[model samples]
Target: MSTPADPGQAEPQFILYLDGEAYEEELRLLATWVHALLLPVYAREVTSAEPWCPRWWEHQEAIARLHGLWLAWQELTDPAAGPSGPALWHRDHLGAVMHELRSPSGPFAGCKQGSHRPKAVPVVEAF
Candidate 1:
């Protein structure tokens, strides 16, 4: 059996689980990475089918998915992850997240190049 990690050293929570200032701060950082690095390096031509929202943060699904990708990136790109860290990140995390977010039926489906169309939340009956 293995010992539990110390509470003080617990891993960071996912962004979707965070609220208030924590969410805002993390989202800001994520946006920086998405714009400065991810978009510049990998963004393909925008099209109707494979759509991309200019305001992706508006989409809860996008935020959750991207936040997970960013967390993986942080860990996998670290020097401690070894020489293949970056390559592993690309193979495992980056491609899947990007594809899902940009797929024709993905989160940004109705969004256009310069427009952001908010998706309606499905209503649920209260218990």
Candidate 2:
């Protein structure tokens, strides 16, 4: 068995884990809300001077923080070796969605092409 890590280490391991999970959850929620709730609304309004937008910048910073937290967690979890945490996070979150969308055509796909197929619906658009 591997020796346990030092709790007094600079990294709060649990915080890293939580941040990474939150990042993925938030991303999935955003994707779900956009795809399931939003509607395509066309508006004919164009001006050279859009209002001074600080919110967009704020959101970008938030996303960057999430990314940083995830990477930091990954580094802590496995120093020289790669951890499956991030990969599993992606597979459990985004990969599942994509898998539902893409059809498994390979014969050895383990099952005879299940009869269930999810609806291919485009639910969100932004101008």
Count of steric clashes across candidates, in order: 0, 0
lDDT of 1 by residue, 1-127 (tens): 0112333555767888889998899899989988998889999999986799999999999999988888888777767778998999999999999999999989999899999999877799999
Candidate lDDT scores, in order, read 0.86, 0.35
TM-scores for every candidate against the unseen true structure: 0.87, 0.22
The C-alpha local distance difference test score for the whole of candidate 2 amounts to: 0.35
Off by more than 4 A, model 2: 1-6, 10-57, 64-83, 93-127
lDDT of 2 at 81: 34
In model 1, which range of ten residues has the least summed lDDT? 1-10
Model 2: lDDT of residue 21? 67
**Which clashing pairs does model 1 show?**
none
Cα misplacement distance, residue 8 of candidate 1 (Å) = 8.7
Candidate 2 lands at a TM-score of 0.22
